[model samples]
Target: AQTVTQSQPEMSVQEAETVTLSCTYDTSESDYYLFWYKQPPSRQMILVIRQEAYKQQNATENRFSVNFQKAAKSFSLKISDSQLGDAAMYFCAYRNINNAGNMLTFGGGTRLMVKP
Candidate 1:
């Protein structure tokens, strides 16, 4: 069985600053994909970034990036130049590449509060 863990239930950051949210997972499969999804007040799950287990370089999208430590099964999300619009519930998800159904195993989300 695979499981994702987010130790911090909630976090806050000042506008324009950087914030890092921690995520760890346990999995026996070698081929899998990790993701960070942001769900704002609108309740839409937005894909923030993704990292493949075979990739050595961390995945980045604009001000959003991931520090993927495969050896430790740690995938953390870094949000730079934080803005008020960035405030949302961020979820860490996992999916095995071999699964045909493509089910996602999500972690207990971390709520990010951006303060002005």
Candidate 2:
């Protein structure tokens, strides 16, 4: 079983600036995947980035990046050059590598507000 936590229910960032959203997770499995997902007003979930538990390097996608700390069980997302399109509900999730259904355990999402 896995449990993820997003301490900040909401976070605000200025346009063109940078913002970091915090996430912590608990998992008994040694091999798993950690991810950051973005859901806009349309409710479509988009994969922001992914980190493998065995990998030490952080995951980065374009303007999005993650600070993944395996020991601390932390996976925080850092949005660089924030834009209006980046405003959305961000979720931290995870799943065992061998999951059959690929079902993901998600954290209580954090709403990101981009201020112009």
Candidate 3:
């Protein structure tokens, strides 16, 4: 069985600062996938980023980046230049690489509150 864990239950960042959310997983499968999804107050689920197990390089988006430590089964998300809009519930998710439809297993989540 695979499980995702977010150690931080909540985090805060200044309007223009940066924040890192920690996540770790336990999976016996060598090939798998990791993802970070954001759920805003509106309850809309959005994909933040994803990392493939076969890739060595960390995945990055505009202001979002991941520190993927395959050996440790760790995948942390770093948000740069955090804005008020970045405040949301961030969930760490994992999926089996060979599974069809790729259902994601998610962590409890980390609530990010941005201060202006």
Mark the regions of model 3 whose C-alpha exceeds 4 Å error after superposition. Answer: none
Q: Which candidate number would show the highest lDDT if scored against the true structure? A: 1
Error of 3 at 8 (Å): 0.5
Worst-scoring 10-residue span by lDDT in model 3: 96-105
Cα lDDT tens digits, model 3, 1-116, are: 88899999999999889999999999999999999999999999999999999999999999999999999999999999999999999999999998898789999999999999
Q: What is the model-wide C-alpha lDDT for candidate 2? A: 0.94
Question: How far does residue 27 in candidate 3 sit from its true spot (Å)?
Answer: 0.4
Q: In model 1, where is the ten-residue run with the lowest total lDDT?
A: 95-104
* TM-score of structure candidate 1: 0.99
Of the pair 1 and 2, which is ahead by lDDT?
1
Clashing pairs in 2: none
Q: Which digits, one per residue and each the tens of the lDDT, describe model 2 over residues 24-113?
A: 999778889999999999999999999999999998999999999888999999999999999999999998899999999999999999
Residue pairs clashing in model 1 are none
Q: Considering every candidate listed, which one attains the maximal TM-score? A: 1
TM-score of each model, paired residue for residue: 0.99, 0.97, 0.97
CA-lDDT, candidates in order? 0.97, 0.94, 0.95
